[model samples]
Target: MRPEPGFLATYLEPAQAARAVAALRARGQRDVRVAAPAPFPELMAALRAPPSFVGWITFPGALLGLTGGLLLTILTSLTWAEVTGGKPVVSLPPFIVITFELTVLVGSLANLLALVIGARRGLRRGHFAQGGPFTRDRIGIFCAGVDPAVERLLRESGAEEVTRVP
Candidate 1:
């Protein structure tokens, strides 16, 4: 079945947002998210999203690219040797430049691809609730896949404003 495509957003002051996030988590709501113009460490702690895999994927992809670049350099030099000043055909120093470039290229590409895939898996852009000027000046805590009872609980918990966008 397709996942629901809406979010419940509430605008609150930083401190209030933190509390709201904690309250949502305490109430067993796992799909909570927060957005703010500036950093909010407490809110981050409350959301507790699982670690991202971009780093892990990038490392191996970069290593493979480096290895491939080095192999290409070595094989090319050996297959088509051009003796200049009798220098060694397999020059590791020059290969370093190619390897480094390839590593960065592959790592960045892999990271971007992973981010796209990850975002598609329930990480689409979120919508905001209308809370007048408060939303621009305050933080927002949003919950996806909200149930009817959760809506009641949010209203009772001093949400100030709650909006569901589908």
Candidate 2:
């Protein structure tokens, strides 16, 4: 059946979803997303999503943590200027433990912040729900714009069910 103007989601088998995505791309349709019960290696290749930059987000945080950790250790060591049994002040070897701990603490906090931000962004872009089957056995192919060509392509590409979402 032809989907309504607000049409947004189509449910298909994994194979069908992959085919539909590939065909949609070939026809130059943008704004297509696939939701599957599990990761489909073939579908991922078809979607061609960009590699996640979450790791890059951690890099800056780790660098800041490293610098901050060393500074914190050095400053604390300098403040406690008690000469201990002919040992030099600002002892590097002893403070190594504190520096490492602080580095890990700061880096972990930063990483957690980045993860929360990423999760919020993802949740904001919610998918068109295709009921419960989608969560178990179905693959959902969601695309914006109610183009007739797109509808026809999806129908022809073997979607088991096609319905619109508000």
Candidate 3:
């Protein structure tokens, strides 16, 4: 048999969305999702989700970039050593430029790749609360594992409208 339905979506202002998300989590609903016209840092904090998965990729990409930069500097300097001005074979100061550029380049590329993959995983798709004018001018909170009692609680909690979607 098919599993039971999940969240019952509701429209609210940004502030109300934050509260509803918090309340649902308090009531042990972990599968909550919210949609808003713009970024809602407050609601994200309420849900306890991380700021962005891109951040996780950034750190490792930076490390890899730096290592690659250092390796490039070392190999190039050693392979094409020039003793024109009695300078050191491995110039540390000049390598900073390559290191910095590589770090930024790799970090940006990794962030873009992560965002694309995330979108494929439904990060960019609309949630239940994404209907009507809400996608353009309002915020929404969708509480998963909902029942009739939960729906009533949401209605009583200042939801402008509640919708149940299959």
Candidate 4:
């Protein structure tokens, strides 16, 4: 995929910027992001972002952890199979502890894996919006695509200043 090396940030009041973002989304502008001085529920309502997929990753991780744990325990027991205390060759009871430990271990590792994947995606060029001075009580509405229509929309939405970045 070709990366968009340049983007535009339209500075505006916090509330107006959030509303502008929402309006832009409603108009089918997909490559939009907002930066603000602080978090606000109104902004979230405006953005209407879908729920995060972290839970989906976590579920698969748990499944992998459980399977890995069971496999490890079963393999270890099979290799050292012996009748002890008049028990079966593969003692299911003793294996439970190992299986549980491995399950938790693998599950934790999966969470770490998911975090790394998410970070990688975020770091990709044009995947993140560049907001300037967002922490200084100014809100920035960043758009990845630039065109005369987009610029006009920003001006009509009450932007105090509009600038481009690469």
- Best-fitting candidate, measured by TM-score? 3
Number of backbone clashes in candidate 4? 0
The 0-to-1 C-alpha lDDT of every candidate, in the order given, reads: 0.73, 0.73, 0.73, 0.71
Clashes of 3: 0
Q: Per-prediction RMSD in angstroms?
A: 3.9, 4.2, 3.0, 4.0
- Which residue pairs collide in model 1, if any? none
Model 3: residues >4 Å from true position, as ranges? 1-4, 122-134
Q: What are the per-model numbers of colliding residue pairs?
A: 0, 0, 0, 0
Give one digit per residue, the lDDT tens place, for model 1 in 109-156: 888888787757634554543453533666666677657766776677
Q: Encode model 3's per-residue lDDT on 1-166: one tens digit a residue.
A: 3433555555556777787778878888777777677777787788898566877887888888888898999798999888657879898888989988998888888888888877576443345422456568766676655478668767777788777744
Distance from true position, residue 34, model 2, in Å? 2.4
Model 2: what TM-score? Answer: 0.77
The residue pairs in collision within model 4 are: none
As for model 1, its CA RMSD to the true structure in angstroms is 3.9
What would the TM-score be for candidate 3 when compared with the true structure?
A: 0.81
Q: In angstroms, what RMSD does candidate 3 have relative to the true structure?
A: 3.0
TM-scores, each model vs. reference: 0.74, 0.77, 0.81, 0.67
